[model samples]
Target chain A: MSDPLQSWNDGPVKASIVEFVARVTNRGSSDHVPPAERIAVFDNDGTLWCEQPLQVQVFFALDRMKHLARKDPSLAQRQPFKAFLEHDLKTIASLGKRGAFEFAFMTHAGISEEGFDALAHAWLEEALHPKLGRLFKRCVFQPQIELMNYLRDNGFKTFIVSGGGIDLIRAVSEEAYSIPREQVIGSSLKTRVDTQNGILTLIKLSELGTFDDREVKVENIGLHIGRRPIFAFGNSDGDLAMMRYTLAGPGSRLALLLHHDDAAREFAYDRDFKLSPLSEALDKAASYGVRVVSMKRDWGKVFI
Target chain B: MSDPLQSWNDGPVKASIVEFVARVTNRGSSDHVPPAERIAVFDNDGTLWCEQPLQVQVFFALDRMKHLARKDPSLAQRQPFKAFLEHDLKTIASLGKRGAFEFAFMTHAGISEEGFDALAHAWLEEALHPKLGRLFKRCVFQPQIELMNYLRDNGFKTFIVSGGGIDLIRAVSEEAYSIPREQVIGSSLKTRVDTQNGILTLIKLSELGTFDDREVKVENIGLHIGRRPIFAFGNSDGDLAMMRYTLAGPGSRLALLLHHDDAAREFAYDRDFKLSPLSEALDKAASYGVRVVSMKRDWGKVFI
Candidate 1:
C-alpha cells in the first residue's frame, strides 16, 4: 500500500531527477530557475516505456496494414506490406529507412482526424504485444510516470518529443502521461480541411511531413515549444539531438539516458538493436557528461 | 494624464463588452464562472488591434518579399512576387486566392525559427503603417487590452485566435496582449528541420498548411484547446467558425462580431472588402443570435 513513487528502485537516478527538478522549481533557493524558463522534455518510447521487438508506431502501422490487406489484396504483394502480411519480421526489419517510411505513410493514410483518434484509443484498449502479452499502456515504466508527475508538481512544464506520429501519441498522452495534447510533438502526416455535405472535416492527407528524430527533434523543440528545455531524458540515439540541445542551453541543464542492461527485468539491447539503436549516442554520453543510467545497476526492480 | 482605457468612449458595445467580462470574472457574484469554464477568445487583427490597408501579416509578407527580392530578382518575376514587384495593388488584389496562397508560402519560406522571431520583433519595433505612422504594437485596442486584464483579474483565461502567421502572432502577443504565447492560435506554415554546418535549424518550408480560417478555426480550437470557449469576439468572416463552435458548447456562451461601420474613425467595409469580408457571415449572424456591434452607432471613439 506504500506509495510506489517513494520506493522507486532506481534511487540514485530518481533522486537526481527529483533534486534537479527541485532546484529548478525553488525560486528562493540558490539553484532556483524562473518559472518562464522551467521546461523539461522527455522521449516517449524506450525512455518512458518499452519499444522492444518493434515500436508502438510500427504496431499501429502493421495493424493498419492488416486491415488494408483484408480490403485490398494488392497490399499483400507491396514491398513493406508484403513483409508485414507474411509476418516476416526479418524482411520488414531489413526494409530499412525507405521501406519504413512508406509503411508509416500508407498505414496512416486517409484516416479522418476523429477516426484516427478513435482507432488509437480502441487499439490501446485491447491490443496486446506478442512478447509482453500486456496492453501497450500497461507496459509503461511506472517510475518514469512518477518522474513526469513529480516534474509537473514542481512547476516544470513537461513535453513528450517522440518519433511517433503526433496524432497517435496525442490520443493517449493526456490520459497516460498527464501531458496535454498540445505539449506532445512528433512526426506528422499532412492534413487538410474538406467540406462535404456542409460538414467540415479535417482529413489526413497522403503526404508525409517532418519525421521527429535526431536533428528534427531539436528543431521541433525550438519550433513548437519556442524555448529550450533545461532537462531532457531519453533512451536511444534518436534522442541525441534533444540531449545536445538541452545541454547546450545556458545555466543549469540535465540530460539522462536510460541504458537497457537488465535482460531479466527488461529487454537488454543497446547498440545491437535493429530499431532505435543507442550505439554512438551511448559512446558519446561519457564525453558529454550525460548520466548514462544502467538499468541493472540503477534499479532494484522494473515495473510496479 | 487621464488613463487611456478610462478616457475612451463608453458606448453600448464597449459597455456590453465590459459588463459581460465583469459578470464572468466576479467570483463571489452569481454570474461568476469557474476558471475551468471561464474561457474567452478574441480575434487578433481588428478586434485586438488594427488591421487597415493590410493585415499585419500582409506587411510581414511584403517585407519578407522585398528582402527575398533583393537577394534574388527571379523571385520578383513570380506570380505574387511579380504583382508585388510592380506595386500594383489592383493586380495583386486581382490575383485573389491563388495569389494570396502563393504569397503566404513564398514570403514565409526558408526562414529559420529563431530568425523568424527576431524578424518579427525587429519589424514590430521599427515598422510603421503608411497612414498610422505608429508602431504596430501601439495600434493594439486599448479597450480590449483593458478588458483582457480585467478578465484575467476576474479569473478568465484569454486567448488570441488569429489569421496571421502563428509564429508572428506569438512573437508579439505576449508583450502586446498580455496573453501567453501558447494561448495564441493562428495560421501556420509547414516547417522542417535542417542541419547547416554544425548547428540545427527549423526551416519554414514553402508549403501552405492550415489557414486557421472558417471551419479550421473550429477544428484547431478543439485540437489546440481541449475546452470550448464560453465567450468569443471576432470582426470578420474568418471568425464565424470559431463563434459557431463557441456558441455550440454546453453552457452560457456569448459571440460578438465587430461591424466596422465608422468610416471617419475606422475603415468601414463589409461586403466590398476582399480582406476579411463580412458579407455572408453577417447575414447569418442574426439567425445565430450573435451580437453584431456597429462601430458607428455603438462607439463614441475608435482607438484609445
Candidate 2:
C-alpha cells in the first residue's frame, strides 16, 4: 500500500522521521544501522494514547483497590488505602513517590502473574475513556501507530517503554500496537514462583521493581534491551533522560517529543500538568535538538 | 541442507525432539502451537557447553577479581578475594550464597554496561576453555547449536534462561547461539543511568538484581518473556523449576535434561558436582517424564 505514515500531516515532523529511517536503513549510507541495532522505544501514556485526566492503568489499579477493600474492610483504615477510598488524590499525591508506589503495590500485588494478566486484559476490554467515549485502547494515536509500523517495516524493532505497569501494558500492547510483551518494558512488582499442588505459578509480591520513569527508563533500556535505541518518542519530562540517552549514541539518532497543544481535539496543558508535566522537557527541546511534534498540526487525525 | 540436528545420533532423545517440534509447528495438528507461542528456553552453563570444573562465567569473574585486586591491593585481604587468591575453593564455598553474590558484585559491577559488554566480549574472544583448549565461545555444544537454529528455522523463539550474568552471556551468545541479547535472561547487577561529563551511560552498581536460578528462573521467565516456553532444556537441578514450568503449559511441551555421563568426551558427574549438582533433577527425570539425553550416547560429536 501507500506509505504507512501517510496519516501524519505532510510536515517537518513526519519528514524528519521518514528521512531518519531512510538514512539509517540505507545499506550504503554512513548512517546505516544494522537491524540488530535499530531499536526504537516509545513512551505509552500520552505519546501513544490519551492520559489527560489520569493514566488508564492507575484508574484500573484504583478500581482493583476498591474491589480488594470490599473483601477486607480493614484496608480502608490503612494510609494509602484510606486516601484511595476517599478519592483523595491530593492526599495520595502528597504522599509522594514512595506513597504512590506503595499504593500501587497494595492494590496490584497478591495475584498470580497470569491472574494479573487476565485482570488487565478484562479491564482494558471493558473500560472506556471517560472523555474520549471509546475503549481505552482505542484512544491510541493513529499517526503514532502508523509510525510504529513504518519503523518496523524499515527493520527497526519498536518497543513501548512506558511509566505504566509492564504487566498491564503487556496485556493489550500486542493486540493494540503489534508490540509484543517482551518488547514492553515498564514499572513492575516483585514476583515469586510457587508450585502449588504441582501447578507452577508466578505470584506478584507486595514490592516495587525498577520504576521505569525518568532516569530509571534509560537504566531499564540498557538492562533489558542492552542496546541504545536510535529512535525514541516521548511526551513529558519523565522521558527527558531516555531521549538524552538515545541521542547520545554514536550513530544516527532521532528523538521526538509529542506536544499536547490541541485543546480542541486533545488536552493542551504543557507547563502545569501535575501527572505528566512537560515543562522542563518542552523548554529544553531546542537545546537538546529534540523534534517537537505538535498534536494539533502534525496529525491529520488523532485516533483511528 | 539435511536435518539440522544431524550431530544428534538417531535415538529416542533425538526422535522425541524432532517429533515434538514437528507436532507443535504443524498447523493442522492437535498439538500445534502458534509461532508466537513457540517459545523455547535453554540453560547455558552445562546444557549448552561444559560447566564441570567451574562455570565459565565464574572463572571469568575470578580473573576479573584478581585484576581488580592488582589495582587496589586492599582487596587482596577481603574474604572472597583472599579465598580466590589462595585458591581456597572450600573457603569460597563456605561463604555461601551471600558471599558468592558479594564476590560477583565486587568483580562484575562498577563499569558502564557497554564497558562490561566490551570486557566480556574480549574475554570470550581471547580466553580458552582450560581443558577444551578452544576459545570459550567455540566450546559450545554442536548439537545444541544445531537445535537452536533448527527451532528458529521452524519459527520458534529460542532464549537462554541462564544462571550466568546477563551481560556476560549477551556479549557472546549472539555469535555462539544466534540468540539476541534481549532474549538472553540471566542474573543481573543493579545499574543506574549516569551522565558523566555530558556522556550518558548505564553504570552497573554493586547491588545484585534477580538471581536467576532455581525458582527465580521460572519467575524471571514469567517476568521477562511473559510467556511459558513450550520447550525447555537444562543440565542441572537449578533448572528443575523452569523445566517444570515449561512442561505445565497446555498443548504440547518438551523438557530435556542433558546427562553428562561421558567422562571421555566430557566430564561425568551428577550427584556430586557441588556447583551445578544434578542430584534431584537427575533422579526424578524418569518420574517427571523429562527426557534425559545421554551426552556420550546421544551425540555423535560434542563441541563444535
Candidate 3:
C-alpha cells in the first residue's frame, strides 16, 4: 500500500538500489547472486546518520572524559583530556584520526567489556544529538534504514563497518540499525581476560589492536567476514578502500558514497573538514564507478 | 521416531544439553533466555572432529610444507622444515604449542586470503585422514553436529572457537558443520591489503595476531561475539578458560569436555599428550561444574 523507501526520492540512487537488488535476486537472471554471498556493508556515521558538528562517539567520549576527570582530577591536565576539558575542539581535531582513536582507547579502557557496554548503552539511551534535538540513535537516515531492511528482506546480511569503537557502535546498533552486536565491526583495542573481585571479565587494554579505517577496513572484513561484500555504502575518503575492495570482487557489485551537501537539514563540510573528509574520493568517484548519493537531491527527507 | 542426537548415548552429557536448551527456550521457565543471548561456542579440532595422532590442521600444514618445499628446496634444511621433511615427529612435538603455531604461521602466510582459502579447500577436498582413511572434513563428530543443529533449531547461534588457523577451518566449516565462516573464530595471523599485479589482495603476514587459546579464547569471544556464551564444548586444557568463562555468566549454562578415552573408535591420549593436553582441566572439571563426556561411554557412534 505504501512505498518501503518513502523517504528516498524517485531518482537514480533509489533506482540503482532497486535495479541491483532485482538483478541479483532474480534466479533466472544472468546477474543472479546466491543468498550466501549477499553481504552488504554500511559506514555508520555520515552514511547512516548525522555526523556533523562532531562524530557521535567523539561526543560520547567528551562526556565520558568529564565524568572520569572527577575521580582523577589530574586527567584534566593531560594532553588529550585537557583538550576535552577545555572544549578546545581545534586541538583535538588537529591530533588527527590516530589521536581520536587514542582518545577513545584511554577513556574507554580499564573496565570490563560488559561494564563498558553498559556505560555506552546508558549514554546512548539518554544522550541527545546537539542539532537534531532528539536521542542520538533517532538521528539515523530514514532512507538508509529502509534500504538496510529491504536488503535483509532479500537475504542479505547487513554489517556496520565503522571507524568508531567496535563496542561503542555495538552498544546501540541493534536499536538504531537493527544490526546485532556480532555483525558490527570497527576499531578495536586489545582486551585481556581478568578475574577482578572473583568475577571473570574481559578488561579493555589501552593499546589499540586494529584501526578500522581505510585499508584496515578491508583487512578486518577479510579476517572477520571471510568473504568480499557484494554491496557497500560510505560517506567520505576514509571509505574509499572498502568501496574499491568490494568492487574488486568478481560478479555483481554496488558501491555508493553519500555526499553531505544538505546544510539546512544536516551540516555540510566535505573537502575542508578534518574528520571524514571527501576530496580525493569525490574526484575519483566517477572513474571508480562508485555512485555518489546527494543528500540534498537524492532524498525526500534526511531523518525520521 | 528417533532422537535427534542418536550418536550420543542417553546419558548425562546428552541429558545436560537437552535440559539446558529446554530450560532456556521455555518462555515460562525462570531460566528462559531471550533468543539474542543464546550463544553456544564449540572447540573445532577435537570437540567436533577427530584430532588424534596430530591436530587435523597440523596434518594440513605438513602437507602444505611439502608443497612449499617443491618451490623452494632449501626449506628441507630449515629447523622446523627439516623436522617435517625428515618425518621427525619427536622434534616437532618437542617444539611445543608455540612452535606448532610458528610452523603454521610460516606455512600459511604470504598468500592472498582468497588464495589461502582456495589452497585449504583443495587440501581438505583431496586429503584423507591417515587413520580414518576418509576425507579430513568427514572426520567431524556426528553427535556434536546434532547438538549444534538442535541448538540452532531452538534459536541459539553456534560459533566455532578454535586454536587452529581461522582461514583453514573456515574453508570447510560450512559443509562439514553447517556453520558459516563469519561465525568461526580462531588464532589469526596479520594480513595486509596489497595490490599485487593490479589485483587487490589481502596477503597474510608471517606475524601472529590473537593466538586464540587458553584465556585468549574468552577474550576473543568477547571481542568478536560481543556477548557471553551460555553453552561451550571443548576437548583440551586449552579450552578450560572458555568453559569457565561461559559458566560465569548470569543464567543457565552448559559446558562439556569430550574425553578421548575410546581407543577403539578414536585414538585416546589425554594426560600424556603434547597437544590438546587434558591434565589440568580434567582435575578441575568437577570443581567448575563442567561435565566430561566419555567417548567410550557417552557416544554411540564417533563419526557419521
Candidate 4:
C-alpha cells in the first residue's frame, strides 16, 4: 500500500498510469475490466533495461561465440563467427537483418535446450555491462519493475513480448523483472525432442522458427497469448506494431513509449543502435495515441 | 475441499492422482514442488472430450467446408472440398495425413484471426455431437473437469497442450475446461499483421507454423511453457513423447494415459479411430511409467 510507484516521478506520466489502472479496476467505473481480461505486455531490451553499447543478448551471444571459437578454432572460418572473434562490427552489420539471427543460431543452437538455458542464466548473472559496470540482469530499470508490480497488484498479467531470443530473455526475466518463464514470449528456434534410452531431451536446432519483430510480434501475441493486450509499453520502432495492436483493442486502453532522454543517467540515442532503432515510434507516438514517457522527467531513478 | 475430484470413482487411478498432488504440494515432503513449478498439461481430442465418429474439429470443418461449397459450387472441384461435400470417407482417408491438415488450412485460414475466433466460438456453441446429442463443449468429461479443478486448487497451473488447431481449441478451452486461452498451447498457423490507418489486424495464413504432436509437443512445451511440466495426461500414441518428457523431469512426476474403454457410457476404441489411434501408448504405458486410466474403471460419471 505504501508507494508501488516509488521510483516514478510525480508527474503526468505517473498520474496517467495510476488513473488508467484505477479506471479499469474500479467496479463502479464504466471502463472496469474483469481481472481475467487484464493483459499487459512489455517489450524487453531498451524498454526494460539499458541497450546502449549493445542489447544484452547480443553481448551474451558475442561472449558465447568467442568462447566457442576459442574451444574449436575451426569455427572462426565463417563470416559471423569470424566477425564475432575479431570484434569486427562492420562485417557483422554488413550481414544486414539476418546478421543478428545468424549469430543467434550459431551461438546458441546445437546444444540441449536446458543446457543452453543454464549457460544463459550463468552468463546473465556474471556478465557485466561494459559501461554500467553491473551485471546485465541488474541493469534492469527500477521504474519499469515498479510499474510491472503495480500493474500486477491491480490484477494485470504482465508478459514480456521481445524480439530477443526467448531462451536468453527467459533466463534473466524472473530475476530481473519478476515475470515467469511461461509469460515471456519471444523469437525461438525450431527444436526436436530426442529420447535416448528413455531420457528426454529437447535439442535446439540452428533454424529460426520465429523472428519476433514488427508485424510478427502481433502474430506471436495471437499465437502465444491469444488475446489483445489492454496495456503495452515499448521503446523501439520494432515495437510500434505491438503498441498499435494494444491501442487498437476495445477497452479503456493505455500504451506508452519510453524515451531514453536522460543521457546523464542512461545513454540516449534514437537512431544510433541499429539493433533497436527508436525514431519512428517516438515521432508517431502522438498520432498513434501512445503516450511518450521521458526518462529524465518520468523516473526518479533508472537502474535498480 | 468437499471432494474436488468427486466424479472420479474409488480406484488406484484416482488414488494415484491424489497422492501425486499431495506429495508435490506438501512442503515437508521430499518431492515438494514449489507452486510455480506445479505445471500440469492435458491433451484435448479423445482425452478431454469424445472424439468418436470423428474428432470435433473434423466435424466442424466438414460443416464449414460444406457451407462454403454450397455457396460456391465451383469449390467442389478440389479434392478435399469435393470429398467433404460428398462425405467421401475413403477419399479423405486416401488423402492421408495431409488431408486433415489440408482441410484445416482450407477451412480456417484466409480470414481475419479475430473473425475466425468468433466463428469458432459460435460454431462450438451451436454444434452438437451426433451420438451424444449434446453440444460438443458440454460433452466434456465430468471426472476430468473435477481432476483439473483439484489440481488448480492445489496451485498447479493447468494447460491444454494438444495437437489440434490453436484457434479452434482456444474458443472452447475457457468454457469447456475452465482453462484460459493463453494457457492453451497447440498447433498454429502462420499469421501476418496488417494495419490500415491505425486499425490493427492479424490475418491467418494458409501455411501451418507448428503441428503440436509427438516430438513437436515437447518442442512447443519448451517454446511456450519454458519449463518441463510435472504432470501430463493424454490418450493417443501421439502423446507418448509428452508423457516421457514429463516423467523424465527431475521430480515426483505423474503421467496418465486415458483409455476409452467404456463403450456403454462413451464409445470405446484404440486403433479403431484413425485420427486418435491409442495402441502404442496403451501397449507401452507400464514400461514408460505412464498410468493408464480405464474410463469404465476410473470414472463414476462421464459427462458434466
Candidate 5:
C-alpha cells in the first residue's frame, strides 16, 4: 500500500504510532480495544496546525476588534483591544491567555451564533499568516493530517480537544483536519437563545463558561466525550493533563508531544510562547512515557 | 423493506416523520441536506423514556440520599434528603428541580468520574420502574427508538439533548437509544482533575454548569454539535426552544413533542408534573408546526 504519512520521515516516533495502532486494532490481540472505544484526541493550535506569531484565532479576534473599533472608536482605547489594534504582541502576551480570552468575549459576544460562525468562516477564507505567507486554514501540519487519517482508517475516532474557541476551531476543522464539528472540543462562552424575525436565534454572551486548558482539558474531555481517549497528542503544557489522562486509562495507551524545532520550515517557539508555554511537558514527557516528536527531525515537510 | 416504525400506528405523526426524512435524504431534491449536516436531536426523560413518578435520575438520587442517610443520620434531617427519605414526593416536587439537581451535585460530586459511572451503571442494572415493572433502561418508548433508527438509516446523526444530568443519561443512552456517549448533551456540573496514586483522576464539583433546558438546549446544540439540527423530538416546555430552533433552520425540518397521555399503558402527567410541566409547548405546539406525539393514540407499545 502507498504510504499514508508521506510528510513523515521513518523515525522512532512514527514507528511507535504505527505499532500502537496495529496492536490495538488487531482483533485477536490482548491489547485490542473495540472500535467504539478507540478514541484519540488532538490539540489544535501547535499540534495539528501552526500557532506561532499568535494563534490563528487571536488574529481573527484582532481583526474583529479592528472592525468594531472602526464603528466605535472607544473599543480601540480598551486594554486588550487597544493592544490588539496597535499590533503590540508584547502587551497582549503580557495580558497572556486571560487578555486573549477577554478579547474573545468582548469581540465575540452579542452576535447571533450563526452570525459568529459566518464571521469566522469569512475571516479564515481570507486571513493569511504573515510569516508563513499561507492562508491560516492552509497552515496545518501535513504529517498530523495523515496520522489522524491513519488512526481513523484503523477504527479510531479522532477528536480535536483544544484550548482555542470551539466555534473558531469548528469553522475550519472539517476542511483543515477532516474532523467533523461534533468531534471538536474547545473553550466556550455561554450563549442565550431568543426569537428574531420569527426565527429562533442564539446569541453569544460575554460570559466565559469553560476554558479548556491543563486540568480543565481533562474535565471537558470527560464531560463532552464521556470516554477516556486511548491516545492523545499536543505540543504545550496545556495538553499535559490530557496526555496523562489518556495514558492513565486501563490497558495499552499512547501519548505524543510535538516539539516545534523546525523554524526553517515552520515557526519554532515553545516554553517562551507565553500564550502556551511548554517547559514541564517537554521535561517530564519521558517520565510519563510520552514520545517527544521533533518536527525538524521527524517531519519531511511542514504544511501541505 | 419491513416497517422501520412498526410501533408507530398509522397516523399523521408517523406520515409526517417518514415524509420529512425522505425529503431530507433525497439527494436530487431541493430539501435534501448533505449527510454531514443531517442532524437530529432528542430530549430524554419523558420524550425518550418514562419520566413518570419522577425522572429516573431523581430516583437514583433518592437512593443515594437513602444510602448516605444511613451513615450520617443528620442527612435525613436535611430538607431535600429529609423529604427524600421520608418518601415525601409532594414536598420533593414542591422543592422541584432545584432539590433534584442539588441532590445530583451532592451525590455525583467528589467521586472520581469513573467511580460515578460505575455507580450509575450499577444502579441502572437493577433499578425498575415503580409502576411499569420494567428495568429503568428498558422503559424507553419503542416508537421513538424505531424513529431514531429510521433517521440514522436515512443519513442523519442523532443526539440526545436533555434537561437531565449528562452523566446519568449517558450511562444508559447507548443501551436504551443506541446513541453514543459523545452525542448525548445534558445538564452538567463543573469537574476538576487531579493525580491519584500517579493515575489521573477527575472529580465532579458541586458547581452547576450548563443546565440544558429550553434556550440552553439550543445554545448547547450550537456549541457541541456546531450545526443546526433539521429534526428534534422532545417533551415538555423545557424542549420548546430546541424544537423551534430545529425548525428554524432552512430547508425541510420537523419537530415533535411527546404528550404522555397513555394512562392505561403508561402514567399520564403533564402540566402537573411540576419538575417538567408541559403546558405552553402542548398548548402552542401547532403554531410553530411542531407535531404533538400522543403516546396513547400514536404508539403501539410503550416499551420494548
Candidate 6:
C-alpha cells in the first residue's frame, strides 16, 4: 500500500539527493533554481545498474561472437573472436582496453542498424546477470532510478554519460531511466547511409570513434549539453571528470560518488579492477568536497 | 513584385517534384500517400549547397593546420600542415583521398569541442565561396530548400545525409535547410569525456570513425532513421549508395542525381575532379533508372 520510494532508507546520501531536488524545484523557497540551470548528470553502469565481473556491453559482444561462430568456424580462430568463441573470459578480459574494443567492433560489425537495435532490446528483456539471476533491466539501481525521476520532476534535465555504446544505452534508457535518447551520451562507431529497394538503411563500421571515459566525458558534456550541469553522480573514477565538470559551474553544485565497499550485498573491487577502476579518484574525493557515499551505510537494499 | 518560385522556370524535373508533393499531400488526390511512407533524403554539399575546390570540412582542416603551425613550429614542416601553411591548395588537393583525410585529422586534432564549434560558426558567417561571392549560407540552393519544405508539408520527414561532420551540419542546418539536428547524418570523429577542475568536457577525437561515403551512407540511414526513404536527391557518386537503397525499398520511389553540367552557372566536373567523383556512378545512373538532371536544363538559375 505504501510507495517504494518512500520506503527507501532514510540516510544522509538519499536525504541529500532529495533535499537538493526539493530546494531546486520549490519556487516559493529561497533555493529555487531556473529551468536552464537545472541540469543533472549520472553515470550509467554501476551507478544506475549492476556492472560486475563483466560490463553489459562486453556480455553482449560475447553473446554475438558465439552467435557468429556457429555460422562461421573461421571466427573461432580469429584473435578476439577466438577468445569469444571458446568462451574464454580470461583471455577476452586480458585483452584489456584494446581487446575489449576489438571485441566490440567484431561483435557489432555487419549488423544492420535495425537488426542491432532489435537484438539489443531482446537481450535487455531476456538476458539475466550470471549471479543476479534477474533481467539486466531489473538490475537497475532503485535509488538511482528514484533519484533520476525526482530530479526530472523538479525541472532537472537528467543525462546519462557512460563509456557504453551510445545506441545500446539509447535502446532501453528511456524506458528504464526515463532519460530521452538524445540525452544519453556514450562512445559511438561511425555509420553510413544505405538506400536499397526503396528502403533507407544505416550500416555500422568497424572504425572506432570516441571512448566516453575520464576527461572525454567532461569534454562530451560541454559539446553535447553546452552548459555545465549543477549536479552529478557516479560510482567510479570514469565519472570523476563529470563530477569535476559539474562542480566547476558558476553557481552552487553537488557531486556524489557511490563507494562500493559493501562486499556482502554487491561485488567490491576498487584498486585492482580492470573495468570501471575507482582508486585514484576515490583518494582525491575528500579534497574536492565530493560527498563519498558508503553503499553499506547509505543504501537500505541492493536492488528493488 | 512576383514570387520567385511561381515565376521561375518549371521544367519536367521541377514539375515532377511539384506533382509528387501535390499527390502525397492531397487527401482526395489519386496518388495520396500514407504518412509512414513519406520519407525524403537530400545530399548536403553541392546538392544542397556549393561544394567546390574543396569541401567545407577540408577547408576547416586547412585553416586549423595554419592555426596549429603558429603554436607548434614543427607542424609547419609536416606534409599536410606544410601544404596548408604555404597556401598551396594545389598540393593539398593533389593528396587524393588519403592525403585529404590526413589533412582533416591534422586540422581537427587537439582542439577542444567548444573551441571547434566557435571557430566553425564564426568562419561560416563570414567566409564566401571563391565563385559564389556570397556568404556560404546564402549560397544554398533556393529551389532545393523549397523542395525540402514542400516535402515536409506533404508528410515527408526530410533529412540531410552528408559527407561532412554531423556536428558542423547540426550547427546551422535548421536555419539553412530547415532540417532538424537529429535528422542530419554525416561523417564524424570519435569522442571522449574528460573532467578538469571538477568540470566535465566532451573531447572530439583526432581519429576517424565512419566515412559517410559510397556504401556507408546507406548503412547510416538504416541505423539512424530506422526506415527506408521514398525520395532521394544527390549530386555525386558518394550518394549512389543512398539512392540505391531508396530505390530498393518497397512501393513507388524517386531517385534523382543533379549533374553539374551547367558550367556558366555552376562549376561542372565529374571524372576530371578528385573531389566528389561521380564518373562511374553517373555512367550507371541511366541503367539504375535514376533521373540524371542536367543543371543547365533543369533550372533557370543556380544560386538563390
TM-scores of the candidates in the order shown: 0.78, 0.95, 0.98, 0.96, 0.97, 0.69
What digit string (tens of lDDT, one per residue) describes model 5 on residues A63-182? 988898889999777786788898899988887775686666667988887888899999999999988888999998889999999999999999999989999999998899899999
Candidate 1 CAPRI grade? acceptable
True contacts kept of 1: 0.15
lDDT of 2 by residue, B158-218 (tens): 9999888888888988898998888899888888888755678888888887788899998
Once superposed on the true structure, which residue ranges of model 4 sit more than 4 Å away at CA?
A: A74-78, A86-98, A196-198, B86-98, B195-198
Interface RMSD of 5: 1.1
Tell the DockQ for candidate 4: 0.81
lDDT of 1 by residue, B1-304 (tens): 5433462366666666667766766766676777756888888987888887667777777887888889998988877677766666666666553356457556778887767888999998988876777887777766677767766876778888777778888888878888767677777776676653454556788886567777777656655554568889898888887887677644356898988887787677787667677877799998876888776766555665
Q: Give candidate 1 misplaced runs (Cα > 4 Å).
A: A1-19, A26-33, A61-88, A96-105, A195-199, B1-42, B60-111, B126-134, B142-159, B187-199, B203-233, B240-256, B286-293, B296-304
Each prediction's Cα RMSD?
A: 5.4, 2.3, 1.3, 2.0, 1.5, 6.5
lDDT of the structure predicted as candidate 6: 0.74
What's the interface RMS deviation of candidate 3?
Answer: 0.9
Order the candidates by DockQ, highest first — what do you get?
Answer: 4, 5, 3, 2, 1, 6
Please tell me which model should have the higher TM-score, number 3 or number 6.
3
Per-residue lDDT over B93-171 for candidate 3, one digit per residue giving the tens place of the 0 to 100 score: 7776667766766788888888888888888989898779998999988989988999999999999999998998899
Query: What value does the lDDT take at residue A161 in candidate 1?
Result: 92
Residue-by-residue lDDT tens digits, candidate 6, B137-182? 7778776876777677667888888887777776678779877555
List-wise, what DockQ does each model earn? 0.24, 0.73, 0.78, 0.81, 0.80, 0.24
The model with the greatest TM-score is 3
Clashing pairs in 5: none
Q: Residues B78-136, candidate 5, lDDT per residue (tens digit)?
A: 88778888878888888766556666567777777788889999999999888888899
lDDT for residue B193 in candidate 5, whole number 0-100: 86
Model 3 agreement with the true structure over A57-107: per-residue lDDT tens digits: 788899999999999999999988898788787877787766776676678
Query: What is the Cα-based lDDT of residue B137 in candidate 1?
Result: 79
Residue B74 displacement (Å), model 1:
12
TM-score of model 5's chain A, to 2 decimals? Answer: 0.98
| Residue-level error in angstroms, candidate 5, position B233 | 0.8
Summed backbone clashes in each candidate are 0, 0, 0, 0, 0, 60
